[model samples]
Target chain A: MKRSERLVDMTKYLMERPHTLISLPFFAQRYDAAKSSISEDLAILKHTLATNQDGILETVAGAAGGVRYIPYIGKGHAEEYLGDLASRIEDPNRILPGGFVYLSDVLSNSQDLQWIGRLIATRYAYSDIDVVMTVETKGISLAQSVARYLNVPFVTARKRSKVTEGATVSVNYISSSLDRVAKMELPTRALKKNSNVLVVDDFMKGGGTLTGMEELAREFDSTVAGICVLCEADFDKEKLVEDYLSLVKISKIDTQKRIILAEPGNFLTETDFSQL
Target chain B: MKRSERLVDMTKYLMERPHTLISLPFFAQRYDAAKSSISEDLAILKHTLATNQDGILETVAGAAGGVRYIPYIGKGHAEEYLGDLASRIEDPNRILPGGFVYLSDVLSNSQDLQWIGRLIATRYAYSDIDVVMTVETKGISLAQSVARYLNVPFVTARKRSKVTEGATVSVNYISSSLDRVAKMELPTRALKKNSNVLVVDDFMKGGGTLTGMEELAREFDSTVAGICVLCEADFDKEKLVEDYLSLVKISKIDTQKRIILAEPGNFLTETDFSQL
Candidate 1:
């Protein structure tokens, strides 16, 4: 193939398999080009991605070395997206009966999921996250998206038991919203022992649900690499957990006046963006 | 930017937003280049994607002309992937209790999900699907993957209610696996009435779950564009629904003997590859 053709295919190929290494010889063989030419094509891809600031192409040296694309958004890009997302969350119409904000639309949106997933993945890019764990229903999609970029398995912790999953490990945590304790479980085979897990969820009020996931991670003898949520209800009376990241922080919600106050969360502060 | 750089950025931009139209003048202005130059760049992208049989760069000519990146996998690609997937599913270790096959690993693999989603999306690429629906738990990830490529919202029908979702519309169906009636619900605001929905699930036995999703979509005044599943147990005496596509079909399973049989599903025969 011609150099131009190789560049096009190489760009698509690298983008599709982020954080995956592709050796020079493999690209040369695939494109039927010289190793030197393949190297030059990769240089162009690396330079293009660097210029965009939305990704990074890390080059590993030596025989077993290759390029790995890292999905990353520049600090400026992260700030702008989070700002816009926070403003969107400020819509009072989203406030539910129990002080919970409806986020189904945002959670289901492909574009929003892509950005959220990329941001979360960027934060834990080098954390050795073997699996992405989240509770049932709401957090499933969030965990799936982050797992996609990280190229890891995502295990959902269910609130109820089903025969489909044979064996499980269960745990209980205070459901602050309901003012009662609730149980969550994960299939025994879903996660392996000693794996590094990153817990994620859609919302965090008192963070009871997240704590349950943390406990479940411990059940499998796994370590909690990090915890992140799309939204955090900062108006909550008290929090059950600390040292977690929230992408969008809801500072206040006025039920009677139908007012909501929100801003970018402390996620950025906790994330090391310098890796990009 | 140079024409080469423009093509690279344009491909990534269009791929990110599938099923959406962009006018030629928008790109022409974005690149500060002539409309003709922009047209040439799109042609390159179109030809590259076409040659790969992985995507379709649709050109909308005339007054409101632009391109669309249609996520598609050719028959050959689909066949190869399903064949490989079937062989992998044949592993005895995957055989769970009650003749169920464990598929969390495949469902959680991003590369596998991408191929499966693209293949399924290819069949329904032009089906006018407004939304994708699936039951809660395992089906959520598959729904999200397909929805992401189709650029549509996915709604999950839950087996149990949660306080997070304010109100819901529910339906009842016979759970053939359990030989009992079960109820499933979707949030009232999750889907719109009269929309076209594509129902998907990870596994199908009697397809009772899919029927429930179909009924739920009807309650929302939506039409079932189609139904598809990642795996369907062929040995499961009777099927409750028809006209559904299965990516892989498991013909038999013996837990005691540690034997299982699997093959490419009906998806290969049902999909048209000429679009490539």
Candidate 2:
């Protein structure tokens, strides 16, 4: 293959397997090119990605050295996307009963998922996340997207018992949004022991569901590496969890008046964007 | 940018925005290159993708011409993956109580979702599907994966209503797996009217859930583009729906005897491989 041809395929290959190491010799052999030529192709890829501010290609030097693609986004891109996302959430039609907002369209969009996945994956690019975990229903898509970019597995915690999952460990947490005690469960075989799990959700009212996930992680002997949500109801009652990241913050929602107020969450100020 | 750099970036850009048209002038302007140079670069990408049998770069020739990256997989690749997937499903350890199979690992694995998504997308690459639809819980990830590949939105039907979704339209269907009448709902604005939807699920026994989704699609005056499932139990009672595609067929499962049988389903014979 020509150098141009090899470069195209290499970029696609590396992007598909983010955080996966691919050695120079492997690329050289696959493209039938010299090692020095493969190195040049990678140099071009790394430069292009850095210029785009969307990804990073890290090269490790050693006998076991290889290049790993880290899915990331520039601070400017993050601000723009989150700003637009917040504006979209501010639409009056989104206000629902009980101060809830209808944001399913954003969550179900392919383009939105790609952007949100890259942003979240960038936040924990170096956190050594063993798996992305979320509860069933709305959060599953978020977990899947982040897990895809992070190149890991995702496990969904279920609220109700199902026959398909063999055995599960259940935990009870206060559902602040519903103002009741709710139970969540995870399959016994879903997660491994002592694994670092990233907990994500579509929405967080008082963060009661996120706490439940943290407790469930403890039952499996897994560590809660981080917690993030797409939207946080900041105007609600006191929060149940303090250390968490949110991409969008909904400050107010008047169901009777069809009003909603939102803005970008603390994820911007919290993320370290020096890599860009 | 140089030709080599442009090829790499162009490939990544097109792959990211599958099924979306990109005019030549846009690429020429973005890369600060002549139209001829941009065309040559896309040619190299199209040829390389065709050689790999993984994707197709479709070029449109007209005043509003552009390129579209169609996610496709070769017939050989499909056969190998589905065969391996079927064999993996044959493990007796996956048999849960009441003839249920524990395949959450496959459903949640990023690599598996990628392959499954590509395979299903290849089958409906030309089906003109406007949206991918599935019920809540297990099928959400599959629907998201396929939707990502197809570059379309996905709408998930819920078994129960949630506050965040507001009003919903629901339908009742017989849950053949459990032999009970169960209700499923979708938010009022979840799907647009008269859209073409492809219904997907993680598993199908009597396909009661799929039927419910089909009914929900009809309630919105939408068309059922197709129905696909990751796995279907062939030994189960008579199927409730026809004209569906399944990747794997589980013929039998004897939990006490520790035996299970699996094989590739009709998707291979049904798909046209001439595009490769």
Candidate 3:
């Protein structure tokens, strides 16, 4: 294959399987090109990705060395995206009865999911997240998005039991919204023992659901790599969990006046985009 | 940017947004290259993709035209993937109590989801699918995977109501497993009227849940573009709905004998891959 053709195929191949190593010998054999030529092609691919500030092609130097694609984003890009997302989320039409905001529209959007996934993956790029975990229904999309970019499988903990799953590990956390203890369960075989899990969700009220996930992680003898939510209700909220990150913080939601206030959360300050 | 660098970025861009049109001028401007140069880059991409038989880079000609990246697999590729998937589903260990098979592992597997999503997307690539719909719990992952490849938003119909989603549209369908009438609901604002919806699910027995989604789609003045399931059980079975596609068909599951039978469904023979 020609250099141009090889570059295109190489890019597509690397992007599909992120965090995986592709040795120079393998690329040379696949393209029927010389090892030196394959190395040069990778250099071009890596440089182009860096120039765009969208990804990183890390080169490992050793006998078992190769290139690993890391999903990274520029600081300017992150700030601009989060700002726009927060503005869209500030719309009062999303405010529901009892102060809950409707965010299914944003959660369901493919483009939004891509950006959100890439950003979260960028933050935890080096964290070695073995699995992505989230409580069922709303958090499924967010968890799936992050899992896609990270090239990892995501498991959802269900609010109620379904016979389809053979055996489950259940945990209870206070449903702060309703002020009741709620139970969530995960299939016993869904997650491996001692895996590093990253917990994600769509919304965080009193952080009760997150607590449930944290406890569930403990039951499996797994460690919580991080906790992140798409939106956090900052105002009318006594938080149950701490040391978590939110992409957008909802400071206020006035159902009577149909007003909502939102801004970028601690994610902006906590994430080190300077590495890009 | 040089041709080498452009090829890499172009591939990444196209992969990120599958089944979406990208104008030549957009690529030309992004790469700071001429129209002819961008055309040459895309030609290289198309050729490489065709050679791999894994994707299709379709060129749209006219005043409002550029290129589209469609995720498709050749017939041979689909057969191989489904064959492997069927064998995995045939494992006796997957059999749960009461004829139910455990599929949460397969549903959560990113690699498995990628192939399944591509296969389903290829079958309905040309269908004017305005939205993708599925019921909550297990089906969310399947819906998200298909929606990702289709580049469309997917909304889940919930089995239970939450305070988050305000007004809703609920429908009833017989729960085959439970042998009772069951209800599922979607937020009123989740789906638009007159949409062409594609219903998808992880597993289908009586297909009561699929019917509920169909009725919900009808309430919104929408047409069912198609219905597809990841796995369909033919053992111990009678089906409630007909005229649907199944990627994998489970012919038998003997709990006492510790045996199972599975194979590719009618979907393989029914789909036409000639467009690629």
Candidate 4:
């Protein structure tokens, strides 16, 4: 194949399998190009990605070495996307009967998920997240998005019992909003021993669900690499979990006045984008 | 930017936002390149994608003209992937109690989801699907995957009530397994009226859940573009849904004998890849 054709195919392949190492010999074999030629093609890819400040092509040197594509975003891009996201989230129409905010529209958007996923992955590019984890229903999309960018499988804990899953490891956490004990469980085989898990969710109120996930991680003898939520209720009376990150923070929600306030959360300050 | 760098960046951009139109001027301005040069870069991309039979770069002419990337897979690739999927699904270990099959592992894998999403998107690439819909739990990932490739938002119908979504449209369907009438609902604002929806799920026994989704779609004055399931149980006595596509068909699951049988489903034969 010509160099141009090889470059296009290589770019697509690398993007599809992020964090997967494709040996130089493998690329050479697929393109029928010389090792030196493949190396040069990779250089072009790496340089082009860096210039765009979007992705990183890390090349490892050794008999088992190859290239891995790390999804990332520039500081400017992150700020721009989060600002727009916060503004959209600030709309009072999203305020629900209680203090909860309706965010299904933003959660369901593919473009928004891509941007959110890329940004989160950029923060944990080197955090050594072995697997992405989230609870069932709403948070599944967010988990899948982050997993896609990290190129890892995501496991979702369920709130109810389903016969489909053979066995499960259950955990109990206080549902702060309801002021009741809530149970969450994960399939026994879904996660591995001593795995590093990154917990994510669509919304966080009092950080109760995140606490359950953290407890579940402990049950599996796994480490919590990090915890992040798409939105957090900053005005909530008290929080159950600390040391967590949120992309957007909802400071206030007045159902009577139909007013809501949202802003980019600690994710902006907590994430180090200067390396980009 | 130079032509080589432009090709790499353009390929990534188009792949990221499939089915969305990008004006030629946007690329020209981003790269600081001439319109002719940007056009030339797209031509190379289009050709490379075609030669691989993996994607389609559709160009629209005139003032609104630009480019749209349509995710697709060749017949050979589809066959290979489905074959592998079926084989993996045939493992006796996957057979659970009461003739159920464990598929959370396969559903959670990012690479597998990518292939499955691309293949399903290929089948409905031109089906004018306005949104992708599925019930909460296992199918959320599947719905999100298809939605990602289709460049549309995906809404998950919930089986239980949550304060997060204000109003909902509910439907009742016969739960063949439980032999009861089960209810499912989607938020009223989650879907738009008169939209075309593609229904998807992770597993189908009698397809009761899919039927409920169809009814919900109807309530919204929307048409069902298509219905697809990742795995369909063929051994089940009856099926509630017809005219549907399945990526893998489970012929049998003998829990006592510790045996299972599976094969590629109608998805491969039903799809017309000749247009590519």
Query: Model 2, A80-152: lDDT tens per residue?
Result: 9999999999999888777778889998999999999999999999999999999988898899999999999
- Pick by DockQ: 1 or 3, better one: 3
Model 1 global lDDT (CA atoms, 0 to 1): 0.88
- Give me the overall lDDT of model 4: 0.92
Q: State each model's CA lDDT, in order.
A: 0.88, 0.93, 0.90, 0.92
Local accuracy of candidate 4 as per-residue lDDT tens digits, B63-137: 989999999889999999999999999889888888889999888999999999999999999999999999988
Best-first order by TM-score: 2, 4, 3, 1
* Candidate 2: stretches off by over 4 Å: none
Residue pairs of candidate 1 with colliding backbone atoms:
none
Can you list each candidate's DockQ?
Answer: 0.67, 0.91, 0.86, 0.90
Worst 10 residues of 3 chain A by lDDT: A233-242
Better of 2 and 3 by DockQ: 2
Clashes of 3: 0
Q: After superposing candidate 3, which stretches have Cα over 4 Å from the reference?
A: none
Please give, for every candidate in the order listed, the TM-score of chain B alone compared with the true chain B: 0.98, 0.99, 0.98, 0.98
Query: Over 4 Å off in model 1, which ranges?
Result: none
TM-score for each prediction? 0.97, 0.99, 0.98, 0.99
